[model samples]
Target chain A: MPETKSQSFDESQSAPMHKALQREIQLARNIQMKLLNGEKPELPTGEVSGISIPARLIGGDYFDFYPLGDGRIRILIGDVMGKGIPAAMLMILTRGAFRSAAGAAQGPGQTLTMMNDAIYKDLRKLGSFVTIFCADWEPATGTFVYANAGHSMPIVVRSDVGTVTLPVLKGVMIGGLPGQIYKEKTSHIQRDDLVFLYTDGIVEAQNAQGEMFKLDRLSGILVEQSRQTAEAIQNAVVEKVNEFTKGLPQKDDITMVILKADGDQRGV
Target chain B: MFKYELIDEEATTVISFEGDLDIDATELMEEEIAPKLYDCSNIKIDFSKVQFVDSSGIGLLITLIHHLRERGIRVRIFHVSDEVRIVFEMLQLPDIMGADVLPEFEHS
Candidate 1:
């Protein structure tokens, strides 16, 4: 096979095109990181923090905090199906829906309902779905109200009780069906209690041996780190996950949010 | 990595999969697996050897099932292990993909 003029010409143009694409992907990853690590609401009585680590250059996992007018902070965490650039695009869409719905909705359940209505058609058309866990935390009153959209349940940790089991609540994932009304569940948050919300990526992370960092291991770590600050606990979990995975490349985005009641009240 | 064996018969098509289903299966699912099922009237997916399925896998699985159903193919899944079944239950796959498609099977 001999190289023709067309082949020579095509080879001449491929390098810069590849370089330009790489630059664009790097910029996209920076934008995603900034949005995901955006401002956290200043709570009067507790602390909240979140982090996201994409498995690829850019990822689909998302988490945000919106301060409500009534002193409660609206928290959203979700994992969009698939990964990389396509998932990252849908994550931005999900963030927009959550932000718009957070201000207008009265509770976590309503927020999810509105979000579903906003993005359901688009998701269906794309053949993708997102599992989300949304919650409204009132620092002064210690009221924790949350709703689920086919996402993992948040683990509640109390120093005296260990990992508190939450009652099961079910709802279809966004785009799973139309006209979905996600039901809400309420729980009391005492002072010093920590709520651990995460995507499946955390537990599903695998090591070189093909072993997963299961829920039991995560819960044990949480129980041991219950005495630390919200940020410390978050870091501890990440460190343990890194140790468990032993530097293996992850296949999914790892993300989590920590909300802890700090015991000083300014509003109810 | 994912691998599958397709067994097509006169009235039914059975596909057995082995290995963890994840993002790696995207191309194979769309280009290879789905095209094979287009002409089948009935399809059954065997999950006996599958041990893990992540979110990406779920997405591919959803697309496959919906694609088949939209074409009037009757699809059902059986032999899912308890661990993978728990993941499916958490995501409410039974409801989203039709409960009949994901029937109960005894865990060995």
Candidate 2:
């Protein structure tokens, strides 16, 4: 009798709590979207665009552009461990660390080192980690310097070469270990070459048949759309993923950042 | 969407994981598998049946190994499929979790 009474009482108490929770989650989604969709920096020699689609109402994927003056923009893309509200909170933490680190760090590698130093203890305490790729793109000089911390390598699509194979550069995921020094690599972005940075969700997105979209399919689309604008290419990839999944709900967050070198080189 | 089997061989316990090791497996790993393995002296993880692992899955795997290793337990992972192995290699799990933990497969 007591158990039945408790069940009835709990049913009465749960509805309002559930409604309030849903409302709060929606509000949180709004805040996250606003932060993620902040103004794109105006680049003179190339155009850059980014987008994120959470597996849930909110997600852990993050991308940001920080203009460092003189036509150079610091671009960062990261995938926090896990999904949903917990991951979203950590993503905000990651964004804060990057903003603070980018202000003083000279290059991508240094920024990563500072970020790791800032967040390693907290991440270890929480039993989590983040995979990130940071890069400084100077549009005026077409210099693309980047560093990776256990994130997927960006796919480069050159008009003449198709998919360009990059040298293997990897580091332990942020928070995996303390005192990590991420090494930097440099590549010149020739005119019309496209650099695609992404989270694993895109390649791992599964269809109803359980077939993944994989890197090969993504690379083919990038190569075919190499001539498109950054925004267009981003849209094309998203469209293809949607088509591939056929409305099956994704289990992980999908995110991508695109950088396309323009034909004319000038500082804005 | 993950399941596991435990086989006791002398003093060593071998655990084989099957299905996608993603967010949904968190509860099972934390509440069931981890608790069962904490007291073991030696453990071997079989990743041959594991087809996919996401960021969240990676976190779970690392946490499980770290906890076991902290207790001075010997852990080794073998029979990882090429796909799953690539993900582990990308994260450089060999370096962080001890190279001996995830050793190269020996062809017999």
Candidate 3:
């Protein structure tokens, strides 16, 4: 009788342990999904389409859109240093920080500064860093002010003209240093202009030949897809990237944000 | 990517990081240390060991700076390497993050 009781107790314990592990995995998946499908903020002027595709169930890439008051819109894109759950969690933190700071009436430069200060200590504790791009657009005046924090250069496409790569302002990766000041630059948005922001995952995407997708290819695609709507352009870019990889395993998360400045649709 | 080391001083905190300062590092920082930002006013970070960084890292830093500034805290940076220093110069981070390369340690 005593032997039977011991066996039963062991079985019960094992069952609960299994259930706990399953629950933890589920929770991790849920968090990753949330990061992938982040909350979308309404646009003050033109339509915006943002997409993030993680190489793994949990990825290190992130993009975010948030509306600022006074006809201003904030857009951000970032890449974490590593992969897996830790990277996903970092993406979440970055998204939250961008939203909170930009939402609190901070401009691109100030926002980057504040973010750097917020994470410097924690980053030291964990020995990690992040690259980011933050920009504020005023639809009313077609003015764009941005601060680059060690991210890729955003491409601007004009309906009449071809695509133009905006120059990156002087900035360092956040959390790597505190008190590193970031500069901001302003540009007048032309009519029917489209801004494209993306992560290295897109350019670094490899093919069977072990060749990277490269920026030239991305630029060509952007030029070809310039006529499409923001959402369509985003979809097309993702599709092209997938086709390029040809069902191969993705090594990193691919994320992109497309912003179109349409004069006629400014009210939207 | 983004990492840092914190040294508690009399009235200031010295933090340093190596490798890439990207999104993953940002999340680790937020989860592990964001709460402590409320306590310090003077903060310094060293980025001599960083190799590459991106926009997400910038966003995280800006947010942190804003948080500390709101509480009347002052932040500084030291020992930024040349390669990474170019990135900071291009983004004009010095204007925003109060960062400057350490002049004392010449890059080898």
**Native contacts retained by candidate 3:** 0.26
Per-residue accuracy of model 3 over A1-268 as CA lDDT, tens digit each: 9999999999989989999978886788787677667666565457777888877766777777777757788887888766777777776777767766776646888888888887767765655667888889876678899987777779888766888757646467777667867789998777588889998888878798867797889888888878777887888899999899997876678889988776233222
User: Model 1, B1-108: lDDT tens per residue?
Assistant: 699999987788999988999999999999999999898999989998889998889989999999999998999998998878877888888888887788783221
Across residues A82-114, which tens digit of lDDT does each residue of candidate 2 receive? 999999999999999999999999999999999
Backbone clashes under 3 angstroms, per model: 0, 0, 79
Q: How large is the i-RMS for each model, in angstroms?
A: 0.8, 0.5, 7.0
Chain B TM, cand. 3 = 0.78
Which candidate number would show the highest lDDT if scored against the true structure? 2
Query: Model 3: what TM-score for its first chain?
Result: 0.87
- C-alpha lDDT of candidate 1 relative to the true structure: 0.90
Give the alpha carbon lDDT tens digit for every residue of B13-104 in model 2.
99999999999999999999999999899999999899888999999999999999999999999899888888888898988888878878
Residues B2-106, candidate 3, lDDT per residue (tens digit)? 556778888988777777665567567677666676688787776678766554455566567667777887766677778666655655565544433333333
Candidate 2 iRMSD, 1 decimal: 0.5
